[model samples]
Target: MSSIIKILPDHVINKIAAGEVVERPASVVKELIENAIDAGATEVFIDIEKAGTRLIRVTDNGSGMSKEDARTAFLRHATSKISDDADLEAIRTMGFRGEALSSIASVSHVRMLTATPGSSSGVMVEIEAGNVKSLADAGAPRGASFEISHLFYNTPARLKFLKSAATEFSHILAAVSRQAMAHPSIGFRLTHNKKPVLDLPLSMSVKERAFQLYGNEITENVMLFSGGRDNVHIHGLIGRPAYSRADRTYQDFYVNRRAVKNASLTHGLYSAYGDMLMRGRHPVGFIFIDIDPALVDVNVHPAKAEVLFRNQSQIHDLLRDVIREGLRAHGMPVISTPEATG
Candidate 1:
């Protein structure tokens, strides 16, 4: 009998991979913005049209790629972030997977114009459905700009999965807000349908960035909390008991500056609040945990939004203790165990 299995073509493989990396327009935004940050960009500007279905553009004043690098950047598993497997254990950059560009390009038409600071001219590369349509010299600033048109255009099924424009735009806004909060030193601007949405200048402190994004009403009720033990550091703003939310929607946690969703960490936040928070209410806060990169694995998910900790219990206890102390200092009541009270 003939062999029934065959290796999929590169284009087919890319389309499949795109499903994991580019779930929605917001996913594209997240990947592009993170790539810019990894490029050492101090300023990032994002523009979206029709809630990113029609257009998505991101420009950044960061290290741009050379002609060769730009051409190879869309190839699967090609990355400048890591040289070998050893680097995975100590990953520091926002992107090392190297699949984002290829995945994104496979499903959409992509135009990239990039120039290094030392280069007198720039190169523009146009790709459609993972095929390069054009590559030529172009005049551009000493940075990089990517414009993606008709995302998931070739994949009508994926396009059908997208939510309403407003819903999708809200997701993009949340993503941009998280990235901006994670890196306060980097300026970020966002516009949707040619209307200005967010314009945050470079900030010296996370609190300042918070104020810009969340306004003073929320920021005023937040208190800074910081503490660490055994080489793990936890620091960020926590809302006072009065600033609780109806759900965990406002709770944000970052491990090594990467926003993640971990149940243990969320429970730890609730534990920190203890009896101070009423039943069915959650706290509005941001908690950042810094630990040796080797102790945390960021490869647990394709989106890199989930992580595995080497010592989860220790980290959980540390988070609880740190926020509990901050709450106590702010004159909030903390529930004590019956044993401890006795």
Candidate 2:
């Protein structure tokens, strides 16, 4: 038999990688918004069309990239967040692996326009199926904007897997809402098919942001808590037992500002409530965990939606105790039960 091994082309490699990063329209929104926040954007605007199958645009007033940097952003593993292994030990930025742009461009049509604060001119680049169609100097404000169209256009298998338009739009809204809650100081707006969906102004604190997003009913029912132990700080709003939700949709967790879905977090929260919450009813609140970056690994997940803690048990116990204490301090009855540390 002849030699059968062959290195995959760059375009092929990117498409394969896109499978992990760009799971759906929401995934594209997530990566782009994180990039905007990492760039220190104070305001972000998202516009969608046909549930993002036709168009998804994200604009931010952040520190824009240079012409050379914008041109290089489409190359896989080309990142400004981290330069060496030592830098990985303390990864704080929202994006570091540098795979998002490349993966997204490979699966859709992309038009990017960016300009830095001191730059006299901006740059515009268009790419289709991982091939650059155009790159030119243009006039733009000091920020970055990306317009992605026809998501999964080159891959029929992925395109067919997408859910209904309403379902997809819900996911996109959830992703944007998570970012909005995580960074309350940043302003965010969303529009779908020329209809306004969300318009959140700058909020000074998480509580204020909650009011803006959920209105007075939820905000009034939740109480703020702040405490930490063993270098793990926990601070955010916790819902009162009287105002419980039917599902976990209202429950949100964040570690160092990155939204995550962890069983340990959910378990600890429910355990904290104990018999105080009725059966089948779940608590609703935002839980923020802050710990040393070196102690938790964010690189474990391709989408960076999860983290591996150095001491999982410690986190579980801390979260349980913090919420328990907060509830008790507020005059809520607490059923003292055996502490369960997972």
Candidate 3:
């Protein structure tokens, strides 16, 4: 064998990365929503046809990208969130890897229409298999909308791995629900085959948001907490022991407004509530963790779903202890016995 290690071409690299990030149509929905959130969108609409196998469209009224930014967004490693090494540590945005757009375009046909708020005209670009098919001026609103067609067409193996439409659609709804819970101020709508699946309106408080997604039972038992050191602020709703879930699936955590699944913190919460709750029960609530952009690492995963907290232990402890304290404050209620008449 020749002793030579060659660099992979950009197209091949993107496709390989796509396997990790865009595992299914639901994965695409997650990334697109992240982009919209990062753009400061208050309202987001996700439209899926054929369980997102045929088409996935995400429209946002967030601050749209400029023409040049739109054109270069599909290039691998091209990102506006991070530039150098220091930028990685102070990441606040949901997408920092800059891989989602490129990985997405590498595996499917992507059409993007974006325009800044004050721009005279907008630009529309189409890409197929990582190649720019067209870029031109177009009439559009002051936002960005991405339409992905024939999902996973370039990767036949990935297509084979997809489940039934109903199963896939459920995954999409779960993701949308997580994001909606994380950002109570942002309005989100989901549609499948032109029929609405989830339509969540903006809420005044985090509890209201949780109630909308998880129902009143969980929110009714919710105890709110807000505390943090320095630039970090943690505000969330914790359910009472009576309203816990059967599993950890109902317990949701978010860092810097990005919904995440963290085992350590979730486990810590379970441990904290152990005295009050019985076995086979999990907490049902939501937590929004806020830290300075420089303290949290948003580049942990391609999906940007995992965040590396600077003081992860402290964060985990703080969350668990605060919740436990709130539960303890409501001391055990005593029942009065009535005198029996003989």
> Order of all candidates by TM-score, from best down to worst?
2, 1, 3
TM-scores of the candidates are 0.97, 0.98, 0.92
Please report how far candidate 2 places residue 51 from its true position, in Å. 0.7
- Candidate 1 lDDT tens digits, 1-342: 998999999999999999988999999999999999999999999999999999999999999999999999999998999999999999999999899999999999999999999899999999999999999999989889999998999999999989999999999999999999899999999999999999999999989999999898989989988888877899999998988888776679999889999988888888887778889988988999999999999988988889999888878878888888888877888764422110
If both were scored by TM-score, which would come out higher, candidate 2 or candidate 3?
2
Q: Relative to the true structure, how large is the alpha-carbon lDDT of every model? A: 0.91, 0.94, 0.83
Which residue segments of model 1 deviate by more than 4 Å? 336-342
Q: TM-score for candidate 3, please give it.
A: 0.92
Worst 10 residues of 3 by lDDT: 333-342
lDDT of 3 by residue, 299-321 (tens): 67767678787777777777666
lDDT of 2 by residue, 1-342 (tens): 999999998999999999999999999999999999999999999999999999999999999999899989999999999999998888899999999999999999999999999899999999999889999999989899999997998999999999999999999999999999999999999999999999999999999999999899999999999788777899899999999988888899999999998889889998999998999998987999999999888999988888989889889888898898989989999876877676
Clashes of each: 0, 0, 2
TM-score of 1: 0.97
- Candidate 3 yields a Cα-based lDDT of 0.83
- Which residue segments of model 3 deviate by more than 4 Å? 1-3, 331-342
TM-score of candidate 2 to 2 decimals:
0.98
